[model samples]
Target: MSTVFWAIVVLGALIFVHELGHFLVARMMGVRVLVFSLGFGPRIAGWSRGAGETEYRLSLIPLGGYVKMLGENEEEDEEKDQSGHPVVVADAPDSFANQGVWSRIAIVFAGPAFNFLFALMVLVMAFMLGVGELLPVVGSVSRGMPAEQAGLRVGDRVVAINEQPVTRWEVLSQTIKRSEGVPLRFTVERPEGPILLTIQPRVQEMTNIFGETVRTWLVGIGPGSGTEFVTYGFFSALVKGVEHAWRMTDMIVTGVWKIITRSIPADQIGGPLMIAEMAGKTAEQGASSMLFFMALISINLGILNLLPIPVLDGGHLLFFLIEAVKGSPLSEQVRLQANRAGMFLLIVLMAWAMKNDLTRIFSDG
Candidate 1:
């Protein structure tokens, strides 16, 4: 029950944020919106300020939501009879179809933009609320490892590597991994005084979380149980939040590329069940952890929507780009076929993800 609840809460909130972006931008661009729905399928409940106003709805399906605007469908602007003659309809000034190309692009792009913005906001809050980080203190030096050979002992607190200060374990580990087997100078604080030691990292074969075997440099030192709740002021948090979001975006983009190149297994893709499981686990960890998880998901959602595939915001932007270049919209038949292909691709992808999720569930059981 807890898992299901948190899943719904997180997914629902993100979907609402996405659709709200389109709604606001469409209204601002003078497009008349007909529906603002939180989900798909039949309307569960809804309200409107008055007749012909945009009807806000909670729908039966929770997988996704959408916003409907006047003249949003390009097909509606054109039709043909059995005799193969073009039938044209008058365009409404406030309809989406009648808007300028740039205006339409802005309205379509708003969904992903809002997602990124929401992620930035939550990350700032998460940082302000304090995040737990492991201090760069060595708890144990592996026997026969480079650290042991270099005389790095237990209780040694690393202050710097090659004169560069590292306060957190994550930074320290990444630095070591990227050292490329080069000898590094480490400055550690001892009871007597600070000591400088030179140690060379060794290339070791390791399996990554993706089940791929890869080689990386390692010193074989583990962090101690020294953790601190680090908090930042408002301005500092804002800077950190932006940096974090950028890092996440880069990481996600790289991951997507890897998957496309077959560097990562396709079966790793997951669907709603996987998200629900993760949401439940994070909620149990605490609000800060949950927020962090949400930020990551929000970033993922933003990047995913920006993919230039048909039936997505990115796809619409692609269409607008082609129209701008050609000085006209694509033929209605071509747009319709492209949209159908995109829809088919999405359905297959969804089904594959669902299969993967169920496989993991049953395998775990």
Candidate 2:
């Protein structure tokens, strides 16, 4: 019950943030927003100041949301005035379709842009709240593994790997994973003295966060119980937050590309259930953990929304770009067909993700 609650809260807040971006930008550009909804489907609750005002409301489905602007989906060819010419509903002074191409692009881009901004905000707060990280000391070395075979033992503090100084367990683990079975020189620190050990990593099959079996290089060493809590001041936190967001953005982009290239298995794609589970687990850990998870998910939302598939923010931007190049909006027929195809693709993808989520749940059960 708590899992579902946290998931809804997290997803609902993020969706509101995303749609707020569109609503604010559209209004700024002088477009008339008809509705500002926190979710899709039938409305659950809502209020508006008066007629001609935006209708702000909550909806049935908490999975996603939208902001609907006047003339956003106007059919130019379907309506006609007294004359034989087409009655362009989108050409109204305060309609979204009447805006310049660049304005439209900005309006569309704001949804995803706000998502990244929200992530950065939460990450900065998390950093200010102090983050716990593991040191590079080995807690245990697996028997018959590369670390054990290479004379690496428990309580050994890894100071460097391949001449690169590593102060954190994360860096050490990532370096080893990316070593690709290469021989690594590790400098370890002990109470008596420091010693250098040459170790070779081996490929191992592991289940990743997405429940995909992946082949990765490993030295079979785990981090010790030594943990450090680092807190940043406001300015430092801001800087670190930007850096963290940038790194995560790059990593996510690379991951998406890898999935596209089949470097990552498609079955690894997860849905709302996975998110709910993670949210619950993180919330149980602590506030800071939950904040970090929310930030990560926010960034993921920002990045995924930018993919150039039709029906997404990026798809709208793509259409604007094409309009800018062609000096006109796309033909209604073409746009309609592309949008239908995009919707179909999204439905299929959602089903696939849900299937993966159920499979993981049952397997674990």
Single out the weakest 10-residue window by summed lDDT for candidate 2.
Answer: 75-84
User: Candidate 1 on 148-258: residue-level lDDT in tens?
Assistant: 999999999999999999899998999999999999999999999999999999998998766779999999899999999999999999999999999888888888788
For model 1, give the 10-residue run with minimal summed lDDT. 73-82
C-alpha-based local distance difference test score of model 1? 0.90
Q: Residues 68-155, candidate 2, lDDT per residue (tens digit)?
A: 8878888422445578676677767888888899999999999999999999999999989998889999999999899999899899
Where model 2 places Cα greater than 4 Å from the true spot, the runs are 75-88, 142-152, 158-166, 171-189, 193-220
Off by over 4 Å in 1: 74-90, 180-182, 191-193, 213-215
Q: For residue 13, what is the lDDT in candidate 2?
A: 83
Models 1 onward score TM values of 0.91, 0.83
